[model samples]
Target: MTEIETIESFERHLRSGASLRGVVLQGLDLRGYTRELASVVLAGSVFLGCQLEQESVQAALAQGAMVFPPFLGLPYLPYRSGLYSTEELYAGFDPSRPESYADTLDARIYAHWSAQGRAHPVSIVEALAQRLHDHAITDAMEELLAGGGKHRKVVAIMGGHSMLRGQPDYRGVAVLARELTRHGFFMASGGGPGAMEATHVGAWFARRGEAELDAALAILARAPSYKDREWLSRAFEVRAAFPLSAEDRPACASLGIPTFHYGHEPPNAFATHVAKYFANSVREEGLITIAKAGIVYSPGSAGTIQEIFQDACQNHYNTVGVVSPMIFLGREFWTRTRPIYPLLEQLAQGQEYARFLRITDSLEEIVQALEEYDRFHTLSTIPR
Candidate 1:
C-alpha cells in the first residue's frame, strides 16, 4: 500500500529493487519509465493521472495494473501530489500590475470553475475532475498536518472575510495568532482576507520582532479592504520587505483552507500551506475538524457565525473523539454585537465542553487557555 507521489520517490524505489506490487503511483509522467514498467511486476499497482506512453499503458494493463489517464484540457492536476504554495498559485502575478492576477494559476482555475457552472457543472466529467482534485488536496493536507513525523497542534481562527486590515479587531487577531504560533501551535484560517489574512500574517512573522510586524501592518493598512486595487500588491510588498528566512519557514508554517466557492476572495499569501478546495462545505468542515487544539473566534459576520455553530455541533456530540477549547477573542463582539457567546453558553449549560468555553478581550487569556488545554490534554492522554 505504498504511495509513490514524486518521480524521485519512484526512481529511488526502483533503484532499491522494490517490487511495484500494490503500489500507488500518482500524478507522475511515466513516459521515460516504459523500460522500468516492462521490467517490474506491475500486478495490483495503480497509476493515477500519469502520463504514460502507449506501450507502457498497454504493458500495465496486460500485467493487471490499473491506469487512470490524465484529465486533459484542465488548468489543474486532478491528482496533485501536495498542497498549493503561494509561489505556485501566484506564478504569473505582478505586484505593480494588479490585472496580472487574472493570469495566475489560482485565477485561471477559478475562471474555469465559473465557466463549468460553479457548484453545478453541466458535464459529469468536469464534476468528477473537481471532486478528484479536492480529494487529492485533502490527502496532501493530512500529510502536511502530520508534519513528517510530529503532529501539528492546530488551532483555527474563524472570522469575517470582510474584516478590514487596519481595524483593531484585525490587529488583535494577528497578534494573537503570532503569539500562539510562537508557543508551538500551528495557526489555521479560512485563508481569505480580513481576520483570516490577519491570522496567517501573524504566523508569517512569528520569527520576527513586534516592530517588524507593526511595519508590515502599516504597509497593509494602505489597502484596508481586499476590494481595494492595491490590496494584493501591498501584501506582496510586505512579503518582499520582510521575507521569512530558510530557517524560519518551518517554524512560521501555517495552514490556509480556502475555497473556490468564494473564489472572488483570493486566498491570502501568508499561509505556508494552502489547502484550497472547490466545495466550501467540505473546506469549512475540514478546517474546523483539523483544529484539534482549539478555535479562536475573532470579530466576523455571517460566515464566521456559521463556522461557530458548525464547530459547536462537533463539540456538542464529541463527534471528533476529543472536544477542544472554543475561545472567543472579542468579549463585546461575541457577547453583545453578535451575541453568539451567550447563546452558546446556554446550549452547553451541562455539557463537558462548557468548561472549555471562554470569552475574553485579553489576548493573553486566549493564549493561556489554549496552552492550558494542550497541557491538560497531553497529561490526560498519557499512560497511567
Candidate 2:
C-alpha cells in the first residue's frame, strides 16, 4: 500500500498514473483535488483526518474509500505525517524570556495533555486522538530511520534526567555520544535534561572539534540544572553559537523519544528528530526497542533502573528477533552504587545475550563494542 502524506506526493503519484487503490492519504486537504479524486480508483483507499468537501466525501464513501473526518478542536494534528523538529516544537520560545516557553508548541501540547488527564483521558475522543498521533509519530520515526536506503545504526543512552549540566557524568556521556555519532552511529535518548540532553548535545556537535564542544559545555554550565531559569536559554545560546550546517545535519542527525508523561521536564533541543509521544510506556519501550545496535546505561536512579530491566527482558527472550549489546558506562555505578550489573549478569548466566553484556568505565570500550557488534551484524545480513 502506498502512503500519500503530502500534496507533492499525491500530485506525483497522480502524474505517475498509479491507481489510488490501497492508498493511504493522511492529514491532507483534498478540497482542491475533487476532480482528481473523482477520476481515480478510490476502492481500498483510506483517508485519515482529511479536509474533503461534502460532495467529495460522499463520492469517496460511495466509491469504497474509507474517509475519516478530522477531529474538531484538537491542539495537535492527529494524523501528522512526520516527526517534530526542534524549530517546530520551540517555535514560540524566546531565549531572553523563559516564560515564553508556555507559548511553544511543546509546552502547549504538554499543557493540553495534562488538561486531558495525562495518561488516562476521560473523553474517548481525546484518548483515541492521542493514540492516533503516537501511531503517526512511530510511522514517521520508522521512515526517518529507513531514509537513505539503509537502516541507521541507532544507539540509545539511558540515564537519570536529574543529571545536571557541567557534571562529570553528563560531560562524559556527551563525549561518548559525540564520538559514537562520528563513527556513523545514530544517537537516541529520553530527550529531557541531564544525561539525555548530553546525548543529543554530543550528536549536535558531531561535526565540530573538541574545543568547540568544551566551550559549549562551559556555556551550559551556567545553568547546571533544568530547574534553573537559564537552562533553555543557555541551550539556545549554544545552538546559536554552533548552528548545524546543511551538510552536517545528515551526519549529526539523532533521535529523541520523549513523552508528555513527565510534563515538567521539557524536551531537549539537541535531537534532530523528535518522536514525542503521549504515553511514556510506549515511548520508553520503543526507545529501548529501536536501539538495535546497543544501549549504554549511564548513572541514573529509578527511571534508569527501570529501563535497564526493560532492556534485559527484551534481550532475555530475544523478543525483538536479535539481541543487542547492553553496555554499562560506569563500572562502579552499575556494580556497586546501583549494583544492577551483577544481578543482570546472574540472570543471564547461560543466555545467548550474556556475551553481549559489558560493564566498563572506558568510553573507548563502549564505542568499540558497538562498532564491532554493528560490523558483525552488517556482515551477517549481507547476501553471500
Candidate 3:
C-alpha cells in the first residue's frame, strides 16, 4: 500500500511486478500502458494530467483511482518550479504590435479566469486548481531560495505600482536595485508595473553601469506608465537595447511574485523569475517574509501603507524570527505628506520594532542600512 511518488517509481514497480496499491501517480502519462494498467492496483490513488485509454480510465476508476485531466491551454502548472517566460505568455504576439497583447496567451487566460470571478467564494473546480497551483508555486519558491543557499540573502523593494516609469523615484529605485543585486543581494517585488517594474529593470541591468541604466530608463520614459499605449512595447524596446548576453546574466536573480488578483496590471518582463499566483494575500505576506535581508519602502498609496503595518506587526511580534530593517525611502512623502513614518517611529519608541525602522530620502542611506543589517543582524530563518 505504499504510495508511488514519481513516474520513475511507478515504472519501476510495473517492471518489477509490484502491486500499486494505495500508490499516488501525479502528472504521469498513462496512455498505451495496457499491461501496466491491467497489472497495477490503483486503490486510493490520484492521477493528475495522466494520459490513459478509455479502458484504462475505466479500470482506474473501478480500482478507486481519482483521475484529473490535463490542464488545457493554461500557461502554468501546479508542479512547475520557476516563473513564466515572456515567450510562453506572449506566444503568438508580435512584439512590434502593441495591440497583439489582447490576443496573447496571458490575456486569454486572464479573460477566462476573470469571467469566473476572484472573490473569496468561487467554483470548487477553479478554486481547487488555483489553490493547488499556488501551493506548487510556494514549493517552487522554496526550491529557488534554497538554490541560492546561505550566501544569498533575499531583499525586496516595496512601493506603489502607480509610480510612472519616467519619474525620478522610478529611476532611483532601479539604480538601487541594480546596485543591490550587484552586491550579492537578490531583488524581488510585486512584479506589476511602476516601482515594481523599476526594481526588476534595475536587476536586469545590474551587470552594466549607471549610464546604461539611464539609457534604458530614457527608452522606457517614452511609455511612462503601464496604462500608456506603448508601455509593453517600449519596455521590450529597452530590453532589446540592453540585451543580456548569456554570459552577462547576473548570478544573483531578481524575482517578481505577482498575483492574478490584480491581473489588470500585467506582470513586467524585467523580472527574470516570476512566481505569479492566484491568491494575493499569500503573495503579499510571502513577499515580505522571504526578504530575509530587509525591505525598502518607497512612497505608495493604501496598499503600501497596509504593507507597512503588516510588516510592522511581523516586526513587533518578531513573527518571522529576526527583525530585518524596515526602511522608508521617501522622507517628505512619509514624513510630511503621509506622516506614517513618524507614527511608526512613535509606535516603535519603546518596542523592539524601533531598532529596525528608518526613514530617509537618500538611496545611499537605504543601501547602507541594508549593508549594516547584513553585517550585524542574523538573517531571518523562519520557514515559508
Candidate 4:
C-alpha cells in the first residue's frame, strides 16, 4: 500500500498519473469532503471497505450516489460474459476462478467487481460499442418515423424457455409472431431458447410461414429442451431453409429478436437485432419492462405466468405511464386453462388498473386494441 496519508498525498498521487489498482478506504473520514469532490475523485476508481465520513455520505446521498454499498449502474448485469456455463446459468454458478487474465471476459469483469467492493466505470468506448451493436433498434425507429417502415410498436411474446420448436403451441406462437409482424408491430422476446427463440424465428421468416416453419419445428422436435445440443442448430437449419438477404427479406420486414444470456442455447440468428445482457434477471426484467408498448402472453408454463402478473403489476400501477395493450393470444389457454386475463379483469374491476387491458382471441382485434391504446394515451413519466 502506497501510504497516501493526507489530502496532499492524495493530490500528489493523482497528479503523478500512476494507475491506482484499488483503494483501501475502510473507515477513513471522508465526511469533510464536498459531495462534488467525492464523486469527482472516485468517478473512475474502486473503493474497498472505506469509511465514508458522514459528510461524504450525506454528499453521496444528496447526489443520488449509493453511499453504503456505492452506486454501480444496474446491479443486475452480465458481470462476466462467459464465466457461467449453460447449466450454471440455468441453475447456479460454479466457484469463480482466481483473479487472473485467463478465465473469460465476463469472469475478469466480475473479478473487478468482486475485488473492488464497488461498481466501477467501464471505458466509454466500450459503452458506445454496446450501443452500436444495438443500433438496428434505433435505426428501425427512425425508419418507421421516416415512412420507410411503419410500426415502432414492440410486442414481446413471452413464454417458457423450455418449450420445443415443433409443438402446437410453438407453431401458434410463430404464426402469432409472423402475423403481428406483418401488421407492422416489431416482435421481441427473452432472446433465449425455447419459446423465445421460436418467437424470433417466426419474425425472421415473417413473410413465409409455409411448410418451412413446420420443417424447422420438426427438426427442433428431435431436441425439445434447451439443454439439448442439437436444439440451436435445428433452429438455424430451419432458418437456412429460407435464404434471407439484405435486399430481399420479409415483405413487411419485421424483426425477430432473441438474447444470449442463456448463451448455451445460442441467440436466434434470425433476430434483426439482439439486445442481450449477461444477467438473466436483468434481461428478463428488461424484456418485460420494455414491452410497455404491448405484450402478448402466449401459452406458456410458470415463467410465462410469472411475467403475466409482473407485466400486470406495471400496468396495474401504470408503472410506465400510458396503459399499453396487454393482449393474451390464446383464448382457451388464457381464459379457461391458464386463466390469466380473467384474473387481471377480476383484479381490475373493483380495484384500480391502467384501464387499457384487453384480452381477446382475434389477432386483428389485438393489433387494433394496441393501436387504440396508442391513440388516446398520453404517457406520463411520473417518478416512482
Give candidate 3 regions above 4 Å deviation. 1-47, 52-81, 120-122, 148-151, 250-252, 378-384
- Report lDDT (Cα) of residue 315, candidate 3: 87
Model 2: lDDT to the true structure: 0.93
Ranking by lDDT: 1, 2, 3, 4
Distance (Å) between predicted and true CA of 359, model 2? 0.8
lDDT string for model 2 (1-384, tens) is 789999999999999989889999999998998888888888899999999988889988998899988988978899999999999999989999999999999899899999988899999999999999999999999999987678888999999999989899999999999999999999999999999999999999998999999999999999999999989999999999999999999989999998889879899989999999998999999999999999999999999999999999999999999899999999999988999999999999999899999999999999999999998888988999
Best by lDDT: 1
Better model by lDDT, 1 or 2? Answer: 1
Query: For each predicted model, how many residue pairs clash, with residues at least 3 apart or on different chains?
Result: 1, 0, 0, 11
What is candidate 3's lDDT per residue for 266-373, written digit by digit as tens?
Answer: 888788778888899999999999987999999899998998888888888888987888999988999988889988898888887688788888888888889988
Error in Å for residue 44 of model 4 = 15
Which residue pairs clash within candidate 3?
none
**Lowest-sum lDDT 10-residue window in model 1:** 328-337
lDDT of each: 0.94, 0.93, 0.81, 0.56
Candidate 1 structure quality by residue, lDDT tens digits, 74-141: 99999999999999999989999999999999999999999999999999999999999999999999
- For candidate 2, report its TM-score: 0.98
User: Could you tell me how far off, in angstroms, the CA of residue 334 lies in candidate 3 after the best superposition?
Assistant: 0.8
Residue 194 lDDT, candidate 2, scale 0-100? 94
